[model samples]
Target: MDEHEQVFQMDTGDYLGDCDYIWAESERERLRRLWLHHAQQLSDFYIKNESYIAAIKVQEKVQELFADAEDNYFILMKLYELLNNSGCR
Candidate 1:
């Protein structure tokens, strides 16, 4: 048997704590960069495997992830349009 009594933790953070949540510009940039990285990886894989259909789906999802960011709209729209216009749809 152990000498010290075991304890379990349930509360992670205080809901009424004196804390704040701020959405900073740098945080937005970081998230955009992360999503773009995943998009690039998926694009590369699809190109190498000729998985056009699957790639289109994944690309749309990536666009959705960045949908709230107006800056990303044009680029994502272009990609999807390319696939559709390329007779891959």
Candidate 2:
């Protein structure tokens, strides 16, 4: 299994000794929310920077974060289109 799957399979006790289950659950949820928030923030940052070339590069990296799928290709294509529409390299 991948590192992420292995981490998910581990119990609270495996990572945090004597931590309350409720607290662990909250922490996990908070982490997920923060990750998503950060991702959006990063996208906005790129957009505001007006660095279309850099944004395209970042979009390529983001595509790699997902497994091979139609959605992944669509996202990449959309990013490319956005860059092209912006008339930036």
Candidate 3:
């Protein structure tokens, strides 16, 4: 092993994946995924009900929340078009 590797065993476990460190991060991840699922369901319901305008409005609200996320903006527009083309209505 290299000198640095021998000096410090990284797996000392003193601070590895501690509850305090992982709790908030994992919770955020879980909530983020749940939020996306509900948002998609809302859009799907709006499309199925033939309320395309309301679906777009929901997308707009999501866009506002993630205004700095260019990829999300693109996805929002794509979802809008995809929902519009869906034969659900």
lDDT per model, in order? 0.53, 0.53, 0.57
RMSD of each: 12.8, 9.9, 16.8
Q: What would the TM-score be for candidate 3 when compared with the true structure?
A: 0.49
lDDT of 3 by residue, 1-89 (tens): 23322322222222333566755776755655555565556766766776777667666755665567576577567666776687533
Error of 1 at 50 (Å): 0.4
Off by over 4 Å in 1: 1-20, 23-25, 68-89
* Residue 22 lDDT (model 1): 55
Ordered by TM-score, highest first, the candidates read 3, 1, 2
lDDT of 1 at 82: 65
Q: Report the C-alpha lDDT of model 1 over 26-46, residue by residue, as the tens digit.
A: 665565576567665665566
- Residue 58's lDDT within candidate 3 is 61
- Which predicted model would earn the best lDDT? 3
Q: Per-residue lDDT for 81 in model 3?
A: 78
lDDT of 2 by residue, 1-89 (tens): 24432343332322243565866776765665454344445555666776556545545544554345365466557767888898866
The TM-score leader among the candidates is: 3
Please give the lDDT score for candidate 2: 0.53
